[model samples]
Target chain A: MYRYDEFDERFVRERVAQFRDQVNRRLSGALTEEEFRPLRLQNGLYLQLHAYMLRIAIPYGVLSSQQLCQLAVIADKYDRGYGHFTTRTNLQFNWPKLKDAPDILDLLADVQMHCIQTSGNDIRNVTADQFAGVAGDEIEDPRPVAELIRQWSSLHPEFSFLPRKFKIAVIASQADRAVMKSHDVGIRIVRNKAGESGYEIFAGGGLGRTPMVGKRVREFLPKGQLLAYLEALLRVYNLEGRRDNKFKARIKILVHEIGIDAFRDRVEAEFARADAFSDDENAELARISAQFEVRNYEKLSARSETFEAARKSDPAFAEWVAHSLFAHKVDGYAAVTISLKPVGGVPGDMTSDQMRFFADLTDRFSLGELRVTHAQNLVLPNVKQDDLHALWRELGKAGLATPNVGLVTDIISCPGLDYCALATARSIPIAQAISNRFADKARQDEIGPLQIKISGCINACGHHHVGHIGILGLEKRGQESYQITLGGDPTENMAIGELLGPGLAAGDVPAAIERIVGVYLDKRADGETFIETVKRLGVSEFKAAFLAGAQNEAA
Target chain B: MKLLDRNGFRTDDFSRAGADGAARLDAVIVPFADLPSTAARAGKRLGVDIPNTVTVEQLAPHFEKLALIGIAFPASTDGRGFSLGRRLRRAGFKGLLRASGPLIPDQFPYALACGFDEIELPDASAARQPESQWLQALGAITLPYQRGYARPSSIFEQRRQARKEAAHG
Candidate 1:
């Protein structure tokens, strides 16, 4: 959790006042809708179908218990008593009034949070591995660098109005939990052969209408040159990125058209011109890193007698063992994932009361440290093994202790037609239906690790493109249909899912998913996971099972 | 229509001296259609010969030639022209900048920060309302290529080094 310095605090305060004036002008009819639209968007306010939506940045998905509590207060005070965590690792208030937005921003500023650059054609909220600090395989924690980038890109003068939105992701681990390869700019912290820590930079990766895996632009950029390298990259894109058509404006398209070699040449040339690193920037990053230091853990025995006894007696704790836990870097501690996807509940959503409870739990069991994973679930990174049972009991009451952290029913979904104006069909209902279909805990456990991602539209907010079984909601004529894709994964071995034959109507989508999962169950070898089955069987088999009925109807 | 220069003076300052102690000069008030070409031709014909200027309904088209431009803020908080002034400076057009027509002293610092060299207050009463009150307030004055310009030792690099030192120390 990086604390705000004097400069950071002042910047956010001034930005809030600036937006407050803009809102006042718009409300007074001094600014037209066309004129005020971009201004409002730059401040993270959107005019959705029903009400104004405010997307708040949770920098690199890190949050203190106090910050989470503040967010809960914002939801209760201004929104519909709950907030939706996004795939980008930020949160959105689905229902905010246009007038109260400034007040909400003011409140956010008080807690060192803002909606700045959360949307619009500017550098967006930087995302990174949620378990950056505590992950056992990490080279270093990447949040300090992420915080530096956050500060540098905030309301940047030249890059504020880019051809399209830019997204950057950082990963400090070899496991690639942050999905760094699927971002506009992906940075991985690595140690060179000489044992000096540096950054391995990737460019031109994105997911949207056109999906691409980023190419390596720099093999090993020195740690101090991160800002200079970024400046060169953005400068080239800002000047040369296509603004003629909205669809063809992303850096990925530019990279594809020019070829990665030529793009690399140009970026390197630009980097050479601006090769200097300033002392001020280094000093600032140093200050930021100091704020992110992990709390010292007490030396303890490797074995936990209490935890072993509880797990032996409790079946619920046993179930939690199979799904909800991950090995921590320290001995006798574990990272506990709090699943928001209770069967038949909305994905990535937490009620106000639940948020407050999470705040308290993080303080008590996790050393006031919490992380929002890219999967839209919360994590308690350093929970002692002895405290797991008590924490699980408290979480069970809040509907968060589902014991299905990475299991089949823990679906990733977006607020599709229910909240998004661009959505052609509803996504929440489909997610709910699928969750209900697999509501039985025994059935879910039997199915094993299956990621079912649903997106309301092609925007892939639900991360449908990276799900084991991806369901994309589309509208044909006046009816809703779901186009399914198979074999997408967002882990270290990332791959975009391939679409099956024809889409299924809304009524048939759930059954179609059941048929596909059933096909996996039948065809899988002994002790194989869903992804393994998909990898071995490929899409043709799933396609045959998914579209068999549609083919029959046509015949 | 009174055509004012960047220094709040009439165009007659270098041409015909003020008659009856009131500034008057030969100025062409062009319509929106003829503003650009006419301003260019006027700049060519005048060639710094006499104190001659052209005024138009909009300033965006003639930003390159006019040493001094006047923007009618129309009403209070009409910020389209404020953007115009900023763009002019960002585009590297450093000349006499004037903001007139319904503009007040409250927006003085913003106008100045946006590259307006001079501001034409409506009258003496508007000008007398404590210019210092708004003058001292700082405005965001950033270079056009601030993000693009990569100096060898930048703020981000400095911050990074500082962090390393603190961590190791």
Candidate 2:
């Protein structure tokens, strides 16, 4: 965890004071709503359906225990008893008075956090892999670079008002846990043939009413030039990106219109003119990197015997070990994922008490550090292997010990019509129905790794585009319907799922999913996964089964 | 001949005449596209021969002859003109750098740092007061771009090295 230095602290404090005055002006009628909308949005306050929703930034999905406790306090004091963690690794409080938002921002600034650039048309919070420093397979931790970008893009004068909201994600490993391919700008950290780490930049990727996979703009950009390259790309986008139609205003549309070759040429020309690469940028990066150096770990011998004995004595513990535990670079340590989706609860809601419990547990079992994954789960990155038994006991007592990571029931859902003002149909009910359908533990284990993502609208907040079985909610003639898609995956081999015939009524959506799974079970070859089976058998078989029931109803 | 400040008090020695009278060369601020018409009228009537300049354009062409250059800020938050002022100074423009059109006193330090010599505040009473604590808290801080210019003297380098070594120790 990087503590805020004096400069960082002062910056956030000044920004908070600035926003406080803006809010006062808006309330006093000195500033009209039209004039104040972008300012408030840049501070992460949105005028929603019934009230204002304030999204607090959780940079790079990393949190200290103190910060988590502060968030719990915010939820208890100002909002409903819980807050919803979003796919961008931010948190949204659905209820906050417009006047009280400044106070909330003031409190967040005390803890080295602010809501700046969480929304509106600007460079948004930069996201990276949740397990950046602790993951064993990483080329290098990407958080230092992510922090540099966070500092550079915060309240940038030249680019505060862009054509549309822009998102950037970075991944340092071969396995794409951050879904870098679907962002507006994706940077993959890799080593070149000469054994030096650098980035492979991708451009023009996004998902909304339109979906695209980013194209490779630079095959191997030297690490020293990351900030300069990004400046050039953003300058080009800000100057020439379209403002004609709101729907066609993203950088993705601009890149598509100009063609990748011509866009690259323009970016190169702008890069030449900007003089972006200076010694100051390198010094800033070095300072940020020093703040993120790995903490000291106690040397301990690997205790396979104790772990094996505990697993042999308890079947429940064995099941948990199979799913919750991940390998670590260090010998006697492990990465533990705390699943938020227990049987039928809300996808990413944690009670204030549960948050406190996790904070305490992180201080005890882990190194007082927590990571929030884009899948809406939390990570205890450096938990010692020998302390697994005690951690499992504490987690079980707090109801945070769900032994279903990446299982069919560990769904990734959004706060749908129940909370979001942009939603057109109910997503929580559909998610609940499906979870209840697969409530049998044995059935879930047998189905193995399946990702069921549901979104209430085409905005894809739930990331239904990348799910293995994606369900998108829509309102068809005053009735809620869910459209199912098959074979979408968000890993390195990313692909958008295909639509499986007509949409199903809300009540019938779970049964339709069961039928599709049943078809997969019948047609799967030996040891073939659901994705592989779908690839081999194609969508025709599943489409026939899905549409057969709809035809019968039509008849 | 005088111009009104944002508080409706006279400050600068420039005035705008009506359409019936001939324009004077005390210094007039006009848009970039109206330069040719203003210049022709000034040459015809006042015979106050000086090069006429437009606000918010490249200053390279008028750097030598112009005594005053007006830079326009369309809105308070739009800061493109600040960069323009910096560019003009970097190109060796030492004339009167006047900021015009919606410029405010709260942005005085930033404008001054970017090389603006005078501010042509708008003539609105409500815009006269300092909006917030921005003025009270305004002070100099180390800018990211300042190091590029402060490196010619060896004494500066020695002081920087001493500070670095002390911090490391």
Candidate 3:
């Protein structure tokens, strides 16, 4: 993880002071609520349904043990002793006082963190793969580049107030974990024919009211020209993106309207003209790269006898290893996933005590660092193979050792109508119900890698658009209606899921999901995943099964 | 509307010119739509106030003809004007460039850095966020991380200089 230098520290301190003044002005009647709204939103404070919610940016989803400790302290002191980690890999304190926001920001700054650009139309926190450096199939670690972008886009003079919120996600691995194709700009670090690592830039990809898989504007952009290329793309979007309707203001809509060919031409022209990058930027990248480089790993055997013995002794530990462990680039090291989804718990909510315990575990087992996944889980990116059993035991003590990483029970949900002012229906209860229904580990394992994502509203904050099984909750005629979409893949083959027939009542969602799963299990071959089964059987079979279940449930 | 620059409040030296050339103030701000019909006045400081919709190419040719260019930000959240300002500067507009809108004081540094020599705030906005607040807001962030803007020194440049000094020292 990159530590904040003096410049970065001073920058955050000033920003906190600036926001403090703004909050004061807002309270003093010097600034109207309308005037103060964007100011507060820029600093990640939102006026939610019952109270103000403060979102803290976990930059690139990476956190040090010390930072985690600070987050726990803040949660205990300012919030209701818990913070909900969002799908963006950021954390939201649901009940922070409006006046205490400045204090919270000051606390975040102490840990080299701040909530700047977490919300609003500004270029939001640039997210990268949680397994960036540690992943087995990575082309290169994207954290250094992600950090450079974070600096470049932070309080950007020319682009602070874009037509709409823009999100950029970078993924270096061939296997997409960061939902790259569904961001405003998705950068896939790729190698050219010459075997030099470069970026494949995808623009106009976003998922909100209008879901779009990004269109590739540039096939291969030199790694050196990353900032310049990004600036050119943003400049085109900033100048040309529609401001007529708020819903149609995203770069996706602009790209969709003008076509990618014309958009590419304009961007290429702008790139030719704009002197966006300098030698200083290259130097900064070098400094950032040095920070991400880990040179302290000891070479060890790939197989660990202790790990084998632990697995033989405990079946639960063995299951956890199969479900939660990811292949590490280094020998004897595995990336361990600490699942936040215990059965019937809120998808991403972690209590203050859990934060402290998780931090202590990270300090002991995983090089004192952890990464928050977009799927609402924490990842210990460098756990030794021998320590897996010990870590599992520690995690089990805190109910963190859930052997359902990509299974149906491991759901991604939003703070819907219960907290979010924008939400029309409840999502947490729906998530809880589904999790309880699929509490059986064997059943979830049988379901096999089904992503059940729920959103309280059409904003898709829960990323319902990309889930294998997306459930969007909408309020229709004062009744909560849940709409199901099948085969919504967020991987390299990204597509918005198709709507399967009419909406179901909120109470009937789990039954509908069960029928869908039942259909999948019935039709699936020996090794077919839920998505693979859906693809093979088509949406029509699932729809037939769903309708049949709905009729039976109504009876 | 109060016209403000790096200096406090300044008198408006420009005005809008009509097609007939009968309605001309000291320095005229010709609207983009009216530019084709309105003949350019020699010795008169001609300026164009462009909407966010206008492209840089549409206004590039007039860079030499205009003494000042005003970018209209209809709303504070609509940031097209910021890009427009940078484009105008890149297009070699040597004269005064102004951001005219109901912008907040928080945007003072952005406006200056984006090549805006002055800000023309609506009377109500000016009354709400006075010159003192704007001045205070300008220094809120001591250094910006960006390059190629109106700022004297960006943080990137400063850091590079410091690094060089440390090597020598």
Candidate 4:
């Protein structure tokens, strides 16, 4: 909801110009592909399997209707009339030409967006909880701090070439919707005994070839010193992180190699050495926080007559409300999650027309803003309860009203071997098969609150390491094989999933998942979710079911 | 090798110290490992060329005796030198700080903002990215977002001053 100031505008424009010049230099053979690769990657241009992909950052997952419309326009004009929203809450146009990337960046700059630091070994797009301001349990809005960080880290002189990519996530609520603990640096807003706001800082949490939850470094860092502390932490990691092996270069690996206490002591020493915090930083924080102030809300009754009538009249409407609606901090408002995962559809993919439709609905129903959730869905953070029925109706007309927010059908998947150059197997088709197997809405509801994440490779872009039912696709011999992991959690109690026995063949994946779900159904107690059932029944039973399924397919 | 400053191409006044260890009156640059032996032979304007891995604490005690500190980048992508430059300045190194390696024009602004006085590029890098590119890249963004550095005044302070003026006027 924050508008770009003159400085921000000029900064993006200059970046675009610089990238354009780089592109020209590449075209003229003044720079080799190896020389140009990192430059383009820092600007979020990737040479994918078939073509170039341009990923644009939706800073902190927040987007205005105007910006959404512009994205739709860019998709139609430059891409193949579609864009895929990533698990990082960014969007990828998979078919942009290298020549057209600068033009696309120019278009994004017009909408206060750019793809800077979206990829590369730099401090990347800072993420926060999608429901920051409107969440019922929020201590403070995390967006202001996220934005301040975005500004400070953008094209940072001392940190542009880190040994590995750095991700920072901020969360204000205890729910941990942003998966804060799995980031390189996680900041949780808290109040001390004196009721003054501060931060609980965690460092070195990530998911990839190696998965480790971040360790708490500072118990209570004053809010004013956020940037200073982050600078100190990054300076330590930048100079000291391993660089000999690319796979072992993440800050999490550094923290693991040398214990968290040593890492914290180094960071603290660096913090004491540098004069990072100053009056100018406080003023900057104030300037940023002023932009995130809550807008005027009308004092409407908490209970809406139209909403109640619609719920009574329509069973489908009630079902959607049950699954999609989230409680808002405000009495008369609610946050509405529009599922991007429809049955048998590719996860996180949206056509240009669907994007335009959502933009229009955003203007009409919610405030003029919506947010992209890390779960690969869109959220209207300020939908009025009075407008819920009408909103549901409009969403249904556009095929956006799928009541599967946390259901089995709401899968998070990556663009595997089909698009990504590094993937060994296809992830989208596998996600589709599983979603179709559980397409029955009643069955999905019966299963209840399952998170199925599928990643095609070990890079873990799809976050298979944290899913309740995690599926990692690997190439065994030549054919595609899928490995299942159970009971992984991404919440405040973050834990990596363990491998459930051996891998299964591609055809047996859906049936294996079915058997796993069947086992859960048989073993679950009253109102127990999939995760709880897995925890109760243990992985041995699910492993037996999966092995049986795999054997049956083999026979 | 080529020397570049904010105004573009510049002449290099410093020469590398020879193995003979003879006294020189003008500026002479010596490797950090050779500093102990070269200190006696060098003149008042002594320069120490350090590897990127060398920390500020290692260089602090010798700061008063040197006129320049050159941080070696090895490769353009190895950004440890940038952080090293900033750390040296933050630790109150008022002497000249030079980033030496094969870096690009795109990195010129970062080099300057991180408190480097000049960039010493290998001949190949200088040939690929000429002086004009470096000069243009220096002015790529006239302002920056950081504070408490030795660079130009931040946009944050500028915006605050503007707000204050508006309020008073």
Candidate 5:
């Protein structure tokens, strides 16, 4: 966990003061609503359907226990006693009053957090793999670099107002847990031919109105030149990206319009010309890396007697461990993913009590730090294997022991029409219906490794484009209709899911998903995943099955 | 409109004239679109009022003869002018760099940091936000993080300097 120094503290405090003054001016009618709109948005306050939604930036999705507790206090004090975690690993409060926004930001500043750039057209909060440092397969911890980007992009003088929102994701593994190829910029830590670790950069990948997978802009960028290259990229985008239509403003659209080669050439030219970069970036990196290197583990055997005994005795505990535990970098620890996707619950919504309890659980079982996964789950990054069962019991007490990480019922969803003004249809109900349909743990296990992501609109906030079974909700003729797409994968082999058939009524979505699963089970070769089966057998079979299910459900 | 620089609010000496006006040696600024039409009067005290999207390549030839260049912000939130100003300075434009629009007090420091010599505010904003508030906003951020800006230097540079001094000591 990175702590704020005097400069960082002063920076956040000044930002809070600035926002408070803006809010006061807006209240006093000194500033018109039109003028205040971009200001509030840059501070991450959205005028949602019911109320103002304040999105707090969990920079790179890492949070200290103290920070989580402060968030809990804010949730209890201002919001509806709960907050929803977004697909970008941000926490969004759907009901914060406009008057209380400045106070809430003041509270956030009490910790080392603010909502800056969370929803603005500028470069948004940078994201990285949830399991950044502790993952067994990591090439290097990406937190230090993520922190670097966080500071550099904060209130950036040159790029404060971009054509549209830009998202940057970093990952250090071949596993691609952070949806690297689906961001505007993706930085993957890789070793070049000389065996020195550098970045393999990708550009223009985004999922929204028009989904695009990023193309490799640089084969290997030296770690030292990351910020300089990013500044060059931002400069080119600010200068020439489309501003005629707001929808066609993202850097993705620019790359798609001019083609990647020309974009690369322009960016390289700007990088060569721009010479205002800092001379002590390595020293700054060393300072940041030291914060992420605070892993303290007691020397213990790889095999935990207590963990094995609990697994052998309790079938429930064993099932939870099998689904939720990830291999850690240390021999005697396991990174536990406490799933927010409970059966028949809204995905990624955590109650204030759950936040407080989870905060305490992190301090007790793992380090005092945790991560928010892009899948809308919480991660205990360095939980000792010896304390697995005790921690599991504590988690079960708070309903955080869902044990459905990457399972069929573990769906990702947005706030949808229930909360979001942009949503055309309801997504939470659809997610709840689908999760309840596949509620049986045994059935979910039988239908293994299925991701059913639902979005209330085409903005893809739910990341439905990357789900194995992508469900997009659209309003057709005053009725909610859901479109299904198959073979969507979020891993290294990223592909935009293909549409299965015409839109089905909302009531038919879960049954349609069940039929799609049947198609996968029947068509899959031995030991093939659902995505593998969809790729090998193609979406045609799934489309046939889906249409048949629609007819049957209607009948 | 009033001109705000580090020296405080001042009166403007130049007039914004159209391309149809006869070229004179007096300080006259025209819209950037009219630069080609006014190229014949290059020896005059010519200036260009350009949008933020204007490229340095377009203005490079006129840098020698131009007395001033004003980049439009249009709206307070549109920050394309900041990068344009930085680019112009880096491209060796030695003339005055002016940010022209309805900019608020908060953006004053950023304008200065991006190589703007002064801010030309529309009359409405100049009256609405007090000059005292503008002065206060100038010192609002005593320390900024990025380098290559005007003093005080970036916080990172300060840290690096401290580290070097410590190493030698």
Candidate 6:
């Protein structure tokens, strides 16, 4: 909800001007495609399979109603009237021309938004918890820190040309909502014994060809020294990280190659060395924190009588109530997660009408704000519990109420061979088939808290490696084969899932998942979730049944 | 090679050292491998050309004798030189810093901000992106958000000043 000031506005305007010039240069043969690739990518413009996809950065996943409306306008004007929300908390338009890019950037800057650092080898758009200020488990709001980082990393002269893409995530909660351990740098806000706020830093975690859980670099770094420490860490990585192989260029490889302790030593030595540019210590931090927009939450009874009555009266609403609501720190408010996955719809795809509808609802049902989740859903961060039924009714009319947040059918998928030039096969269609297979509401509720993540390739944009039921699509022997991995977790105790034997045919994937779920249902103890059962009985127990059924389906 | 400072085109001041060594009274640019020989002669102003990978710690010993450092960027995108330049400056290298590569006009600002006094481009790159384009690129953004070599106050400090003025007024 923080609005851009004159300086920020001027900054974005100048960036748009700069990008426009770059585009002109590329058009006139002043810059080659090879030369202009990184430049265009930094502006969030990617040439996809058939067309140019324009990605817009919603910094830290927070967007104002006005900004959301503007996105709808752009989607209608430039794109094919729809936008896909990416797992990185970005929105992408699959069909945009190169000429229209600068105008689109100008439109984004009008709403205090720009696509800078959304892609490319530079430090990417910073991400944080979707339920930052409203979550019950929060220690401190991470938005201020996320914004400060965004400002500091924006056009960083020393770090703009990193060996590979760098991602940073911030969270201030016991519940890891931002996939904290899976980023290049993960910062968790904490208070020490003396009651001073600090950070617990994680370094070098990523999922690409090789998946890894980031090691904790600093147990407790003083909050004020975060930027300086990050600068030191990046300087060491810039100087020492491998550039020989493109696939192995991520900071995770460096941390894995040289042990975390050695990496930490180099970072600490650099940190203690002569400070080149001491980051805007606490002065800029205070300013951002003050501008983080405190909500004037209305005081009311803890239980909303209307919400209670609606839950008892309407089964459809009750079914949605079970999974959609997250506990808010404020007594009378609840964070409502609006699922972009509706039955068998394209996961994370939102029509222009849906965008406009959601923007309107943000003003009426909640405050004039919303947050995009890493799971490709949207969260109304601070909705009054009293307006539960009204919000649900509005959502139902727009096909936004799916009643599946963490359920079996709620999947994370990437636009694969259909759009991405890097993909081996299609991911969206597979996600659709699985969602339709598990469409039975009763079955979905029975298999609760199951994450089915699918990535078309090993880039893992869909985050299959961290998924509870990971499906990786690989092209084997000129055929699309899906490899299944089990027992992966994305929390503090993060683990990479293990492979479940050989890859399955495309048609056998849904049947294989069904058999695996059947195995879980049979083996689970009382009230055990899918991941819990997998953890308890080991993934091997379900393997025999899954492989047996998958073989039968393929034959 | 084209040598460019913030103002415009510039001529090379230091002549490249030969295999024998540098002239005692002349400004000489010696290769990294030939530094030991050149430094012993104690020229009027000694400069070394080294790859970006060389650490500031490795170069710190020669700070007193060295007057210039030309960092080799094998590719424009290999940003190790920028970080190395900053590290050298922070480690008390007061001599001139030069970024040598085929970098575009777009990268000129980053080079300057990272403590490079000038950039030396290969002949082909200089022909492709002439001095006019590079000079225009310098003024692309009159003011940027972050602080660099010579800039006193960033937008952050500017904001603080505005806030102070608001409070006092």
**Regions of candidate 5 where Cα sits further than 4 Å from its true position:** A276-279, A553-555, B18-25, B33-44
Instruction: Summarize candidate 1's per-residue lDDT along A1-555 as a digit string, tens digits.
Output: 788765567768877877887676667665456556767888888889899899999999988888899989999999989999999989999999988998999899888989998998889999999887777888878888898888878866456666789999989887888878888999999999999888999988877778788889899998778988897788677656776788999999999999989999988976886647555556566777878886677676778898989999998888887788888888889888888888898988888888899999999999998999889899898899999999989988776788888888889998999999989899999989988988998888889999999999887888888899888998898889889999988876879999987777877777888888889889999999999999998888888887886676457
Model 5 agreement with the true structure over A1-555: per-residue lDDT tens digits: 788888889989888888888888778776678777888999999998888999999999999899999999999999889999999989999999988998999999998899999987888999999999988898999889888889888877778778889899989988998999999999999998898888899999998889999999999987677888898899898888888898899889999999999999999999998664444777788888997796578888888999999999999999999999999888889999988988999988988888899889989988898999888989998899989999989888877788789999889999899999999899999999999998988888887888888889999999999899998999999999999988888888899999988899888888889898998888778899888888898888888988887877778
Q: Model 3: per-residue lDDT, tens digit, A180-255?
A: 9899999999999999888999988988889999999999987678888888889899988888899999999999
iRMSD (Å) of candidate 6?
1.6
Docking quality category of candidate 6 according to DockQ thresholds: medium
Looking at candidate 1, what is the lDDT of residue A246?
86
After superposing all C-alphas onto the true structure, candidate 4 shows an RMSD in angstroms of: 1.7
The regions of model 1 sitting more than 4 angstroms off are A278-280, A552-555, B1-169
* Fraction of the reference Cα-Cα interface contacts (below 8 Å) that each candidate reproduces: 0.06, 0.01, 0.79, 0.54, 0.51, 0.55
Question: For model 4, what is the C-alpha lDDT against the true structure?
Answer: 0.89
TM-score of the first chain alone, every candidate: 0.97, 0.98, 0.98, 0.98, 0.98, 0.98
Q: Model 4, residue A217: what's the lDDT?
A: 91
> Which pairs, if any, clash in model 6?
none
**Model 6 over residues A1-555: C-alpha lDDT tens digits?**
667778888888999999999998888777778778889999999988999998899889999899999999999999999999999999999999999999999999988999998989999989999999878788888999899889878878789889999999999987787888999999999988998888999999999899989899998987668778888899999988899889989999999999999999999998897344433456677778877766578997889999999999999999999999999888888999999998888988989998989999999877889999989999998889999999999999887888999988889999988889899988999999999999999888878889999999999999999899999999998999999999989887788998998998888899889888888989889999888889999988788988788677668
Tell me the whole-model lDDT of each prediction, alpha carbons only. Answer: 0.76, 0.76, 0.88, 0.89, 0.87, 0.88
Cα RMSD to the true fold for all candidates: 7.4, 5.1, 1.9, 1.7, 1.9, 1.8
Q: How high is the lDDT of residue A474 in model 1? A: 89
**Every model's DockQ:** 0.09, 0.13, 0.77, 0.64, 0.62, 0.63
Write the residue-wise lDDT of candidate 6 on B65-169 in tens digits: 888999999987799998999999888899999998878888888888888999988888777676888888887766667644445556766876776788799
DockQ value of candidate 3: 0.77
The residue-by-residue lDDT of candidate 4 on A452-505, one tens digit each, is 999999999999999998999999999898999988998998989889867887
Interface RMSD of 2: 6.3
User: Regarding DockQ, does 5 or 6 come out ahead?
Assistant: 6
Q: What's the TM-score of every candidate structure?
A: 0.82, 0.86, 0.97, 0.97, 0.97, 0.97
